[model samples]
Target: MLLLLCLSVLSQAAKAQETWEVFMEKIPEHLQVSLLIQDEEGQTLFSQSADKRIPSASIIKIPILIALMEKVENREITLDARYSLQATDKVGGAGELQHLPDGSGITFRYLAEEMIRISDNTATNILIRAIEMGYIQDWLKKNGYRDTQLNRLMMDFKAIEEGRQNYTSPREINDILLNLWEGKWLKEDSRAEIMHCLKGCADNSTIPSLLPAGTVVAHKTGTLDYVRGDAGIILGDKPLILSVFVENFESMEEAESAIGKIALKAFRDFGR
Candidate 1:
C-alpha cells in the first residue's frame, strides 16, 4: 500500500508537469496570456505570467461585489435597500438595466446579481456610486490585492480615454476566488450569496463552455476589444481555483477560444 501510494503521488506530479509543458507549447504566439491554477491546499498546479497586470474589463465587478458585501457586513448598506437609477448611470454595454427607464429602482442585492451574472454596466455604475470607488480601492489594498485596482466606473469612456482603465493580475484575481472559497473575509452567508450570483453568470462562451457537462464553476468573465479574462473556483473532486487573462489577442473569438482550451486542459488534467 505504501509503495502504491508513493507511485500514485509521483504519477500525479509527472502528469501535472506534462500539462504545463503542453500549455506552453500550444499557447498561441500572438497572444499574451496570464494564468494561475491552484488546488484547495494552495498548491500551484500551473502558472504563467501570473503576476502580469492585465486589463480588467467586467472582471472588475468581482472586487466591486466584495466591497459592496463589506458594506452590508458593516451595516453601511442593506441588500434590500432600493437605489434609484438615473439617466446618467446608463451606459452602453452587456446588460439589460441600461434600457430601463431613468427612474427605475432596484435593490442593492439585485444590482449586484445583475452586475456579476450579466456583467451589467448600468448596475455596476450604480453600485460603484453607492460604494464609492475610493472605498473599493482602499478595501482592495487593505485586503492585499495590490495589483487589482477599481480606478474607473464601468463604461466611463472619458476615463478610459484619459488612460485610467481598471486592471488586475491573474494571481490577484485568483486570490479573490481563493478568499471567497475559504470564506476569509466574508461570513458564510455572504460567501454563499456571492457564489450564488457567480454561478448564475450568463456568459458561457469562454471557460465554462469548454468544461465537461455538470461541472460546477462559480466564475465571472470579462471582455474588451483586446482582452478576455475568466476567474473563479471550479467545483469538482479536486476543486481547483483558476484565473486566466488574455490580452492583445487578434480578436475576441480567438481570445475566448484560447481561454476555453486552457480551461479544458485544466479540467481534463486536474478534475477527478
Candidate 2:
C-alpha cells in the first residue's frame, strides 16, 4: 500500500509538470509573462518567473484594500466616514467615480467597494489619501510583502515619467491570496467584505473571461498600454490561488487572451 501511494503521488507530479510545459509552449515568444498557481495550502502547483517584479497597474489596489481594512479593524478609521470629492481627486481611468460631480460625498466603504469592483482610480486615490501612503507601506513591509510597493497614485503619468511606479510579483500576490483564503489577516467580517468586493469585479476580460459562465472568481485585474495582470482566488472544489502578469505586449486583446487561457487551464487542471 505504501509503495502504491508513493507511485501515485509521483505520477501526479509528473503529469502536472508536463501540463505546465505544454502551457508554456503556447505563450507568445515576445511577451514577458510571470505566473504562479498554488493550492489552498500555499503549495506551488506551477510557476514561471513568479518572483519577477512587474508594473502593478491597478492590482496594487488589493494591498490598498487590505491596508484600509486593517485600519478599520483597529478603529483607526470607520467605513462610514465620508469624503467630499474634490476636482483634483478625479482622474481618467476605469471607474464611474470620475464621472460624478465634484464635491460629491462618498463613504469609505463605497470607495473600497469601487476600488476593487470597478478598479476605480478616483476611489483608490481617495482611500490612499485617507489611509495614508506611509501607513500602507509600513503595513506591507510589516506583513512581509517585499516585492510589492505603492509608490504613486493611480493615473499619475507625471509620477510614472519620473520613475515612480507600483510593482508586485506573482509569488507575492499568490501569498496574499492564499492568506486571504485561509482567513489570516483580518476578522471574518472584514475578510468577507473584501471578498464581496472582489467577487463583483466589473472587468471580466482576463481571469474570469473564459471561465465557465457561473464560476466564482474573487480576483483583481490591472492593465496598462504594455502591462496586464490578474490575481485572485478561484473558489471551487480545489480552490487555487492564481496570478498572471504579462508585459510588453503589442495587443491588449492578446495579453488578455493569454491571461484567460492560463486561468482556464489552471481551473481545468486544478479544479478537480
Candidate 3:
C-alpha cells in the first residue's frame, strides 16, 4: 500500500509541476489531451490530466466488455446467448459488419469481440443494450471508479446530438486496466475472456504504433470528428499503462501527431 501510495504521489507531483496550459504551450496547437503512463505493478509512472474526465469514444467498450464477462461468470448470461440487434443501434465509421446482411444476428460474446477487434460502433451499442444498466453503472462504483459510464448505446443520434458522449477519465479507466492486468479486477474465467476479447482489438494506431514491432499491446481507440483517444497496456519488462485523448482538435493530422509524440516521450521518460 505504501509503495502504491508513493507512486500515486510522485505521479501527481509531475502534474502539479506542470499545468495544462503551460505544458501544452510547448506541446502544439488545437488539442485537448489527457494522458497517463504507469508501470506493470499498477503504479503510475507519469500522467497528464490523468483523472480528468473527457469524451471516452470507443474506450467505453472496455467497461462494457468487463460487464459482459462478469455476466457470463454469474451464469446470468452465457457466451452462447444470442443477442439480436436492431436498426436503432447503428452508427457510422470503422465497422463493415454493421452494414452486413446478417449483422443483426450475433452472439453476446461475438458482440464483445467485434467491439474490441473492429472498434465497431454498432457492436458497442448492441452490447450496451444487452447488458443491464444496473450492472453497467454499478460495476464502476463497486470498483471505486468515480467517473466512467456506458450510458445509452453509442451513436444514439439524439443522445450524441445532445452532447451525451460517454465520459471517462484516464485515471479511473487506467485503474480498471491495471486491475485486469494484475488479475484483481474480475473472476478468473471472466478475466481470461476479457483479455481474449481485447486481443482482437483492430485499431492499433496509437501506443502500439509507436512501440517496437512484435511488442504486445492490448489497447482500444475512440474517434469522432471532435474527439480522438487511445488507451491500453504496453508490454515490456517495464510495462506501462498509457492513454491519450485529444478532443476539440483543429485537425486529425495534428491530433494524431500529438498522440504519438506525447506517448513516445512519456514512455521514455517514465521507463528511464
Question: Which one wins on TM-score?
Answer: 2
Model 2 C-alpha lDDT per residue in residues 202-244, reported as the tens digit of each score: 8899999998888999999999887899999888789989999
User: What is the lDDT ranking, best to worst?
Assistant: 2, 1, 3
Candidate with best lDDT:
2
Name the weakest run of 10 consecutive residues (lDDT summed) in model 2: 17-26
Q: What are the TM-scores, per candidate, against the unseen true structure?
A: 0.94, 0.97, 0.84
Residue pairs with backbone atoms closer than 3 Å in model 2 (clashes): none
Q: Over the stretch 1-272, how does candidate 3's per-residue lDDT look in tens digits?
A: 99999999888767744643465577665567788877877766556778888878788888888887877777887888776666666677767556866536778777788889988877777666667766788988888776797666666668877766678898887888888888885778788888787766876676666765677778888887888888887666567788888877788777877877766666555643
Which stretches of candidate 1 lie above 4 Å from their native place?
1-15
Q: Rate the local accuracy (lDDT) of all candidates.
A: 0.88, 0.91, 0.76
Report, for all candidates in order, the number of backbone clashes: 0, 0, 1
Model 1 accuracy (lDDT, Cα):
0.88
Question: What is the Cα-based TM-score of model 2?
Answer: 0.97
